[model samples]
Target: MIDPLQIDDILASGGALSKYFSSYEERGDQIEMSKLVLQGYEENMAEVIEAGTGIGKSFGYLVPAILHYEETREKTVVATSTITLQKQLVDKDLPTLMKALGKDIPFALLMGRSNYLCLRRYLDNTVSQSIFASDPTSEDGKLATWVRTTEDGILDELQALPRGVLKSDIASDFELCLGQKCPNFSRCFFFKSRKKAESAGIIVTNHHLLFLDAKKRCDNDEDYTEKALLPPYNRLIIDECHNMDKNATSLFTQVFSYYGFLWEYRKLVAVKHGANASNLITLAAGIVKGKENEALDVIKELESAEKIINNLNSILVMSLSGSEQRVDKSNYSFFLSKYSASLIAIKQSLDKITSLLNSIIGKTAFSDEDSYIQQGINSAICTFEGYSSFISEFLNIKEFKDKVYYLTREKNKNREEVQLKISPLEVSDILRESIFEKLDSVICLSATLKVDREFDFFRNQVGLDQREILSGCFESPFDYKKNLLLLIDNGKVLYKNNQESLYFDHAAEKIISAVRASGGGALVLFTSYKMLEYVSSKALSELAGFNILIQNGELSRSQLLKRFRDDKDSVLFATQSFWEGVDIPGDSLRLLILTKLPYPQVNEPLFKSRCEKLESEGESSFMMLSVPSMIMKLKQGLGRLIRSKDDKGVAYILDGRMNRSREYFLSQLPPCNCPDDFLDESLERRIEDFLY
Candidate 1:
C-alpha cells in the first residue's frame, strides 16, 4: 500500500512540485483532493470528487497515481473526455511530475483502432490491387511512399494527402482487420501502441476509447480481463466526469446514416466492375457446376439488388422531405407512422438484397480468391441485415419501447441527408454493471459536478449511489467575487414561444455593443447553430472594425482560435463545443457573452425521453434534470472567463428569462454585478472599464 504521508508531502507548499512549476502554489483543495484520491486507491473504494478549476486537478490525481504505481507496481488508467486534456496530461503534467519525482514512469497513450493505418490494408490496396485498381503515379503511389518512409503508420501524420483519400482508402476497417493472420501484423502501429499500453504503468486515454473498451468487455461473455483493449487495471480516473453520462450513452447508441450506406454501395459497385470482377464470376460458375446461365443470373441479381437499394435510399430521402427540423420521438411518431408503407418497403428491399448476397456466398467454395470476395459479401450482408433490423425495430415501437429513437437532418458537403439514431433511456445500469462493478477503484472528477452545492443529480446521472460512493465538492481557489462580474439582461422580452428572429436581432445588437465597448477580445457563445449564423449575419456590418471569426466558417476551429488569440482586438462566435475545454488565459479573452441559456432542445429525442422518464418517476423534470444540466453548462461557459487569479472579465447573459429564474441561475453562478437598468449607459461604461 502507498503511504498517505508521502503523497501529502509531495503536494505541500515547499514540496517537489514547486521545484519544477515556479508559479505553483500549495492549494488546500489540491492537497485535500490528493489525499482523498490516495485513500480511495489504498482502500480500493470508489471516489467522486469535484475539484474546482485552478486546484491543479491533474496534479492532484497524478501525484497519488504515480506514487501508488511506483510503490505497489499497480497499473492505473486515467481517462479524460477530450483530446486537449489527454495531450495536456501526456505532454505537460506527467513530464513535470516525472521531473519533480526524479524518476522515469512508464506511460502510454492509446486511441481507437481506426486512428492508426493498417499496413495490410495499405499494401493490399497499393501492391496487390485487390480492392481497387491503383495507378503507381497517382494518390496510391503517394500513400505507398508514406507507408514505407513512416515509422508509425498513424493516419493523423498523413495530413498532406487529399481529403477523403485516407478515410475511404487507407484507414483501418474494424470489420476487415484479420489480426494475427495478417502478413503485416508484425509491424502494425496499432498493435505496437497496444503492446506499449499493456506494460505501461499508467495508460492515458479519452473517455470514448475507454467506454468502447468497456463495451467490448461487456459484449464478450468470456473473461476479457486479460484480452480487453485496455490492460487489466485496478484503478481508473475519469476527468471531466460531467460528460461521462453523455459519452456512455453515445457508446451504447446506434446510428444509421443514409450517406454511409451509399458510400458502401458505391464501393461494392466499383469492385464489381474492376479487373478482378471476372475472377469472382468464374468462381461463382465453378460453384454452380459451370452453368453459365446461372452465373449470369447471379450477376443480374446483384445489379437488381443495387437498383433496389438505390430506390430505397431515394424513398428514405423523400420521407424526410419538409421534416428538416429536429423532432422528438414523440413528435416524430405520427410522421413515421404515416410513412409506414415507405419504411416497410425499405425493409423489404434490404431483406431482398441480403438474401441475394447470401445465395451467392452459399454457392461459392471457400478458396483463397473466393474467400476474399466472400469477406466483402459478408460485410455487405451485415450492412443490409443491420439496416433491415433497424427499420423493423423502428416500425415496431413495442420492440424498442425502452430505447429513445429520434431523427434529424444533416448536411454532408452541401447535400442534405437524414440520420436515424437510437440511444438508451439511461446508461446508469450499463455503467453500474460494466464499469463500477468491474473496477477495484474509480475516481470521477470535474469542476462542474455539483449544482446548488449538491452532487445528488450528478451522482444519480453517473450511476453512483450515495450509500456506496464517497463524494465531495471543492470551490475554486480564485476569488470570483473580486475577479469576475456577471451581468444578466433585465429586459421584458424574454426568449419565449419561438420568437427566434426577434431574439436573434436583440442578441446581435447586444453582442455588437458589448464587443465594441470591450474593444474586442470577446467570445460570444450561442446555444444553436441557427442562432449563431443568424447573429453572425446580422452583426457583420455592425461590428465592421473588429475581426469576427465564426465557428465552422472558412477557418477550422484551431485556426479560428489561433487567429482570435493572435489578434487581440477580435471577437469569436461559437456554439455548443466551445462551451467547455477551452483555455484562453490572460487578456486574450476579456468578455464572455452567452446569447441564451444552454438548455437542451426540447425537440431532441434523448433530452425529451430523459425528461419523460423523470416525470414518470414523480420528479420535477425542470428542477431535477433540465435546470441542473443547464447549470453545469452555464458553469462551463462562465469558466472561460477568469482562468487565473490575475485574470478579470465580465460574463454577460442575454436571456431575459433570467429575470424570473434569477434565483436559480444566480445561486448556481459566481459573483455578479447586476445593474438595475441592464441597458443603461453606466453598464456599458463599466464593461469598458473592466476591459481596459
Candidate 2:
C-alpha cells in the first residue's frame, strides 16, 4: 500500500483549497478528510465523516479522490444527493481542483434519461415535425414554438413557462421512446449524455440515477443495459448519505396516474381524425379497464374519455407545421379552449373514479388479504390525488397546458400477471453492492448522518455492514459561542396540543421579529407546504420593505435564492429541499429559523413501514428512526449558514421538541451553546455581533 499523503504537506501546497475557497475551516476539514479517505482506501474499509458547516467537504473528498486515483491509476465514482451539487462537482469543484493539482482528470455528469433532452422530442417537433406543421395554430403548435426556442427538450430550462410544460414536453419513457429506431436518433440527447459518461474517468451522478442504473440491470442484463451508467470504478464517495435511504426507497416503489390517462384522452380528442386515433383509444381504454375491479360504468366512462383524448392528439398532430413562424392562430385558440374543456371533463371523470377507488379501499375486505393488493389500492389513491392536481393545473389558464402531452402505458407481462404500475422505492441496496461494494475504497460523507455521533442509524439505513464502517467528526472553524447561537426555547407557546397551524403562527412571529432586529436577513426553514404558506404570509406582512421570499410560491428555489443573495435586506423561508447545497457567503444571511424539529412524520406510509420493522426489535421508533433522520436534515439546514470564515449566523428552533420531547434527537443537532439571553428582542443584536 502507498504511504498516506501528508495532511500538513498537502495543506502547505494550498492548492484548490486555497484558491476560490475563502473558509480556512472548510479547507482544513477538506484536507483532513482527504487524508483519512486515502488512508481508509488503503486499508479497504468504509469511511464516514461528519464535517460541520463551513467545511468545504466537496473539494476535500473530490480533490483527494481524483489525486488518489491518479497516483494509484485507479478509477473513482462520486455521488451526491442533489442535481445542483452534482452540477457543482462536474462544472465547478472538480475543474478548479484539477487546475490546482495540475492534472488533466477525466470527469462526467451522469443523470436519469429524463434529466437529459429527448432528441426524439426535438426531431418530432423540429425536423419531420408532428406537433406543428400539420396544425400551426393548434396546442401542438405552441409546443413546437417552445421547442424551436429550446436547444433540447430539457424541462428545467422552461421554468418560466407553466407547470405541466416541462413534465409533458420533456418526459419520454424508454417504452414510449422509439430509441435508435426513431427517425430522430441521429441527434438523441439522452445517448449523448450517456456517451459523455462512458468517456469520463470520474463520474458524478445523483442517488436516483445510481439506483435507476441498478434497476435497469435487474430488468435487463443485456448490452447497453442501465449498468452502462455505472462503468468500472475503483472508489466511491456518497455525499449526503442520510438521504440515501429515502432515495433508495423512492427508486424501488412504483405508481401510475389517471391524469396521464386523461391527458391521453384529451390528446385523442384533439387528434380526432388522425390515422392512429381509433387504434390508440382502443389500446388506452384496454389499459384503463385492466386496472382493478372498478364498477363497469366507471370503466366505460374512462374508456370513452381515453378515446376522446386519443382523437384530440391525432388532430393536433395533423394541424401543425415544422416552421415555428407558421403557427395557426385560430386553430391554436380552438384547440386550447376545447383541450381545456376536455381536460376538465376528464378531470371530473377521474375525480369520480378516485372517490370510487378510495371507497373501494378498506370498505370491502380483500379476499386475497395480500400486501400487493393493498399496495395497489394505495397506489391508486395516490395516483388519483396526483391526477386531480394535474387536472386542476391543466384546466387552469396556464401557458404550459398547450405545450404538454400525456400518455398512459399498459404494462401487461402476461394474462395471468398482476399488472402493477411501477415506480422504484429504494436505491440503497443497489448503490451499496453495485457502487460501494464494487469500489476498492469508499467514503460516505455528510454532516447529518450520525445523531449523537452514533453511525447505527445511517449505517442500517444506507445498508453498510457495521464491521466495515469507520467514522469521525471534524469541528467547525467558526466560534460556536460567539458566532453561532442555538435557542433552546421550550417555552415558545404552541397554543394547543399537536396544533400545527398554531406552531406556524408562533414560529412566524419569531422569524418576523428576527428580520426586524437583523434589518432583514434571515432564512426561515419549514418542514412542509402548509407550514411554509402560513408562516410566509405572516412574515411577509411584518417584514415590509425587506425581501421576504417564500418557497413553493411564485418562484423556483434557485430564483428565490438569487433574489435572497442579490439583496442584503432579503429573507428566504424554505423547506427541506433548501436544507443543503446552498452557498451564501458574507452577511447576506445571518439568521437561520427552524419552525420545528425536522422529523419525517412516522405516520407517513413509507416511514410507517420502516418504523414497524424497527419496532419489532423493541426499539423506540422516534430515537432509532425519526430522530436521527431529522437531526441529519437539521444539520443540513444549519450548514447553510457560516458558509465561509467571513460568514457567521444564529440558528433558532421554535419547536419545544428539541428541548423537551426527546433528548436523543436534540443531542444529534450541531453541538453549540444556547444564548445567555435567547429572547426575540435580543435576537438581532446577537446576530449582528456574530456577523461583525
Candidate 3:
C-alpha cells in the first residue's frame, strides 16, 4: 500500500533530513523502521519495532507520522513512557522534524490531571489560599502571582512552592475539578491542555496518562471516541513499549493504606496549632447558611473512617495476629473477617459523608461571585463518593477474574503501615480490547522489547499477538562488539543456592575492584535497594578515594544524575529507576555492573499470583514466566553502557544466574566480546584493558 523507496529516500543523505543534521549521514535501520511504521499505518494493524540505540528511533516513526498527518489531515497520538521522553519529543525531536519538512504542524503535550495547578483550588481561601497573604508584596503573594502568570500551569515548573502543599491539594484533580461550573473555568489549566489537543495534528502524552485516558474512555457505556480528555486519534505510537505491562498494571492497581488515609483526613480536616487550617470540613461548615452543624456532620463520617482504619491497622499489626503478608478471599478467616468489616465500615462512612455533602450542596447556594464555594463542595462530594465506590468494588472486588489481592504491613522508621492492594494478574486482555482492538493502527517500539532475540515474548505479554502484527528487531547502529566487552561471572563465588545468600559480600569486592580499575564513572545496578546499600557499604570504605553517589539518599534521582554526569570520575550506585532512562555517554560513564539477574521477588504479591496461576494450568512457571521477563530486564541493564557509536565501555554482570541462559540472552545483544572464561581477580585488569 505504501512505497518503501519513498521512506528510504527521505531518510538517506542529501535528502530533506540532511538539512536538519550536522554531519547528515543516513541510518539504514531507521529507514527500515520507517517503512514498517508506514506499512502498519496503511494496513491498520499493530506493528512492533525494536530500534536499537542511536538508530534515531523517534524520527523513524515521526517522519511517517508527520507525512501522514499532512496527507490525511488526521491526528496521530505519540505516547512515551516518561515525562522526559515526552518533553524530548515536544522540545527536540518534533522541532527538528518540523524544520526538515518545512511545515508548521501544531502539537501539544498533555499530562495527567495532577501535574497541573488548579486555579479554583489555588484561590479557595478557606482551604487552599488561607496560607498565602493577599498582599502582592509578601513572599506568599509573589509565589501566588508567579503561579497566576506562569506560562504552563504545571506544578513541576514551580520551584518555590511552599512545603505541605501536596499535589492533590492544589493540582487539578478529577474529583476536585468543577469544569465550566467553576468561576475559574475560563483559565482552567488541566482542561486547557486537553482542549489544546482538540485541534492539534499531533498529540504527545506519556504512558500513565495514555493508559488512564484509555481506561476511562473504554469503561464508559456510551462511546467516548470523540469525547473525553483526549482528542479522537485513530493511530497511536507507543515508544518504550516494554513498560506497557507495568504502566497498565499500575492504572488497574488499587491500594488503600492507613497512612494514606490519614493524609487524606488531614487534607480534609485538621487542626494546626489549635487553628483551623486549609481543610474541606471547615470550608463546608462556613458555607452553610444557618445549618453549620449539619455541614460539620461530615466530620463524624471522617472520624468513623479514621476509627475503622485504626482498628484494621491494629488488628493486622498485633503480634498474635494470624494475618499473613498476602491476603485474599481464600486466606485466613479471622483476617478476612476483620479486613472486610473494616472496609465495609469505611465504605459506609464515606457513603454517609457523600449523602451529607449532597444535602449541604442542595441547601447552600452562592452568589455568582462565590460560585467556587458551591463547586468546591461538589468536588469534595466527588472525592468521598470515589473512595466509597473503590471500597464497594473491593467488597465484591471487580469480578476478581484476573486480579491479585493482597494485604501487607510495611515498617516505616517509627510506625508500621498496613496496606490493602489489588492489581491485575494480567493486562493482556484489558489492553487488547481497550487499545489494540479499538485503534485503527498501533505501533509499540522499544530498545528492550525483544527478550532472548524474539518478539514473541513481548507480543504475547502485551496482547499484540492476538491480531495480525508486523514486527522487526533493528540492531543498534552502534558497534557494541568493538566498543564494549560483556563480562559474565560464572566462577566459584556464584550463588550455589538461594538460601546460602552470601554472594553480595563477594559481589561487593568485585564491584570495588571493578570501580577501582575503571577509576570510577561506574553505574552499579542491584535487584533491590537493600542489596545496593549492602554493596555500596562494602565498597564505600575501600573506594573512599572515588566519589560515590547512592540512590534512596539525600539527593533526588535527577540531582544524583546531574552530579554523576558532571563529575565524570564519580560512581552512581542505584536500582530500578536508574537502570534505564539514563543517557550518560562518552567518558562520564565507562563502566556498568549489574550485581544480580533482575528476577521478580518471590514474595511479590502479583508475581507470586502469576506463578501460581501458571502452575495451576500445568505450565512451567519458572521457564514460562520468570526467565524471559528477567532476560528483558537484563537487556535493559546492558543497553545502558553503549549509548552512542563513539561511546565505549565495559559492562559486567556479577550474577551467576545469567550463565544458565547466557547464550540466549547473549544472542539478543549486539555482537560483543562475551568472554566465557574470565577470572575474578583478573576482572579489574580485563576491564581496564577493554576501556583503554
Tens digits of lDDT, candidate 2, 32-99 = 77678777777777888887665667766776666666777666777888877887787787887777
Q: Give the per-residue lDDT digits (tens) of candidate 1, residues 106-156.
A: 998888787788776565443334232244455655666677777656675
TM-score of each: 0.89, 0.71, 0.91
Clashes of 2: 53
Candidate 3: regions farther than 4 A off = 1-4, 123-149, 158-161, 181-186, 221-225, 270-279, 314-324, 337-341, 363-368, 389-401, 408-416, 496-501
lDDT of 3 at 148: 64
Best by lDDT: 3
For candidate 1, give the lDDT: 0.76
**What's model 3's TM-score?**
0.91
Residue 489 displacement in candidate 1 (angstroms):
1.2
* Among all candidates shown, the one with the greatest TM-score: 3
Rank by lDDT, descending? Answer: 3, 1, 2
